[model samples]
Structures are given as structure tokens and as C-alpha cells.
Target: MEINFKGKRALVTGASKGIGRDLVIQLVKCGAEVVAVARSRELLENLKKEVPSIEIVPLDISDWKKTKEALNKQGPIDLLVNNAGLAILGPLTEVSEENVDELFSINVKSIINISQWMAKQLISRKAPGSIVNVSSQASMAGLENHSVYCATKGAVDAFTRAACTELGPHGIRINAVNPTVIMTAMGKIGWSDPKVAAPMMAKIPLKRFGEVHEVVDAILYLLSDKASMINGVCLPIDGGFTAT
Candidate 1:
């Protein structure tokens, strides 16, 4: 189905690269005004050079106070994508306290903060909106060395379900897309070795990692009116890996 976002205003975090960057470009192409947020000002500027119409917000969403202030200043947002995240991989027994804190700050806490802000904005305006939180397969199935990452995304899915009960009353929808290893710059680095990637690939029925656009298409659909009735779902874009 062709998804359209014309006349919509969207807020997308992690807009500097991977799935978030592509989402911004696609949203603009579909005639939505987009506010792109990321910590790397230089990368955001580069993205702006490519998509001149996008508005970039160079701030770390982990800082709850500043993130709230920045988001409050934006105009009415019809859609929100909580896409900013960090992954600190290590054996569970070897995980550091600092790493856990950093992971939760960005992956879990930032999402809650941003989602609350978006929900309140939509609520006060008496507007109906959609929120798509970018999550991961790690949340469902245990992956070696992904203990902290899994914990964060698991929190996101739980929050999505719980928040939907509150947001639904106001005609707002919230959902999450848990994607498998998409072949972005980071994904390539993480699974570059055939030995490392083979085991995971074997688990997927498709026998391959996902592409960035594949995940982007799913997010855009969830964000668009096409998914108006779809709420509080942790949809998997994992090539049936989780199903297995």
C-alpha cells in the first residue's frame, strides 16, 4: 500500500544516519514537514545539504531537561519516531555499570521522555497522532553480548503497550518496530565477519540481513494514516527470525 504523510508534521530522533536518516528523506518526499534530531551536528548538516527542507535539531535526547525544552518549542507534531539509540555489547557478566547507564539513558529513558512530550503535545491540541518507536529483535530473543541493549528495547516494548491504554482514549496511536540486523554502517561493522554473521543469518528464513529501506518502509506505514487502527504493537521486521 502507498503511504502518504501529506500535511503532517513529524519529529524523528537519530536522524543523522541509518534508518532515521532515510525516514526523514522519505517523509519529506511524501510532503511532511520534518524535525530531525541527532547529537552530531556535522552529520545533520550534511543530511540537510542533501534534503534542504528538513529542520535539524542538534541535541542529545539523553539530556531529559534540554530535550523536553527543545521538543516543546517545535510546532505541532503529528507523528513521532523515537529512533535514537546506543548499543554497548559485552557479556552479561562483564557489563559495566557505566555502560548500562549510558545505554538506558539513550535507549530507554530518552524514548520515554520524548514519547511523553509528543503525547502531551497531541493531547493538548486535541489532535490525533502516531508514534513509532524503533526497537530491536534483541528485546524478544536473547543475543550473546546484547544484555544491556536487550534490556533497553524490552523496556520500550513494555512502555509502548502500557502507554497505548492512555493514549488510545485521546485517539492517539503508539507502536514499535523491532528490526533485525539491518545492513547499515553500524550493522556492517557489528557483523562483518562471516563467522559472526552466519549463525544469525541461518536463523532467519530469508537467510540474510535486512536493508535500511526495508525497515524505513515499515516505519513510514506505521506513522501514516494507513495504520490508524494499529496501536501498541511490537511489529517485527526480522525476516521471521523471531518467529522461529
Candidate 2:
């Protein structure tokens, strides 16, 4: 289907690179006025050169106090994509307190804080809106070294479900997209070793990693009115990896 978000206002976190950057560009292509947010001002400025129409918000979403202020300044939005996350991979036993704290602070806490703010804004304005949190397939099942990352994403999944219940009456739809091994720069380096990636790919029926745009397509679908009835669902763009 041809999706057009003409005249919509969107707030996208983690908008500097990877899937987040792709979303900002694609959302603009669909005609939405997107506020691209990330910690890197330099990268965001370069992104602006490519899609100058998008508004750039240069702030770290993991900073609780500043994040609240930054988001509040945005006023109101029709679409919110919570794509900012930190992935620190290690075994559960070997995980340090710092690793756990930093990961949760960025991945879990940020989602709740922003979603709460957006939900309130939507309710106050008496308007309907959609929220798509970029989670991971690791949340569905454990990976070899993604213990903490998995935990945070799993929390994200649970939060999305409960948030939808409370916000449903307020005309806010909250959902998550869990994608596996997307072919971003990090993905390539992380999975470049055949020994490390072979077993993971074997599990996926398609035997290939997802492209960035495919995940972006899912995010846009959830944000669009086309997914009106799809609420609180953690849709997996895993190439059937989770099927087995």
C-alpha cells in the first residue's frame, strides 16, 4: 500500500544513525514533519543537509531531566518513534553493575519517560496518536551474549503492552517492532564473523539478515492510520526466525 503521512508531526529519537537515521529520512519522504533527535549534533547537522525539512533536536534521550525538558519543548506530536537504545553484549554472569545500569537507563527508562510524556500530551489535546518502540528479537528469545540487552527489550515489550491498556481509552496506540540482525553498520561488524553469525542465520528460515528499510517499513506501518487496530503488539520483522 502507498503510505502517505503528509502534514503529520513526528518525533523520532536516536535519529543520528542506523535504523533511526533511515526512519527520519523515510518519514520525510512520506511528507511528515519529523523532529530528528540524537546526541550527536554534528551527525544530525549532516543529516539535515540531506533532509533539510526535518527539525533536528540535538539532545541525549537517556538523560532523564534533559530528556523531559527536550520532549516537553516539542509541544505535541502525532507520531513518536522510540528508537534510541544501547546494546552492550555480555554473558549474564559476567555483567557488571555499570553495564546493567547504563543499558537500562538508556533502553528501558528512556522509553517509559518519553512515552509517558507523549501519552499525556495526546490526552490533553484530545487527539489520537501512535507510538512505535524499536525493540529487538533478542527480547523474544535469549541470544548467546545479549543477556542485558535482552532483559531491557523484554521490559520494553511488557511496558508497551501495559501502556496500550491505559492509553487505549485516550486514543493512543503503543506498539513495538522487534527486528533481528538488521544490516546496519553495527550489524555488519557484529555479525561479520561467519562462526558467530552462522548459527543465528541458520535459525532464520529466510537465511538472511533484515535490511534497514524493512524495519523502517514496519515502524511506518505502525505509525500510520492504516494500523489503527494494531495496538500493543510486538511485531517481529525477523524473517521467520522467531517462528521456529
Q: All predictions: root-mean-square deviation over Cα?
A: 0.8, 0.9
Q: Which ten residues in a row have the lowest lDDT in candidate 2?
A: 67-76
Cα lDDT, all candidates:
0.94, 0.93
Scanning candidate 1 in windows of ten residues, the lowest lDDT window is 1-10
The local lDDT score (0 to 100) that residue 244 gets in candidate 2 is: 95
Which digits, one per residue and each the tens of the lDDT, describe model 1 over residues 1-244? 7777888999999999999999999999988999999999999999999999999999988899999999878889999999998988889999889999999999999999999999888999999999999999999999998988999999999999999999999999999999999999989998999999999999999999999999999999998888888999999999999999
Off by over 4 Å in 2: none
Candidate 2 displacement at residue 25 in angstroms: 0.7
Pairs that collide, model 1: none
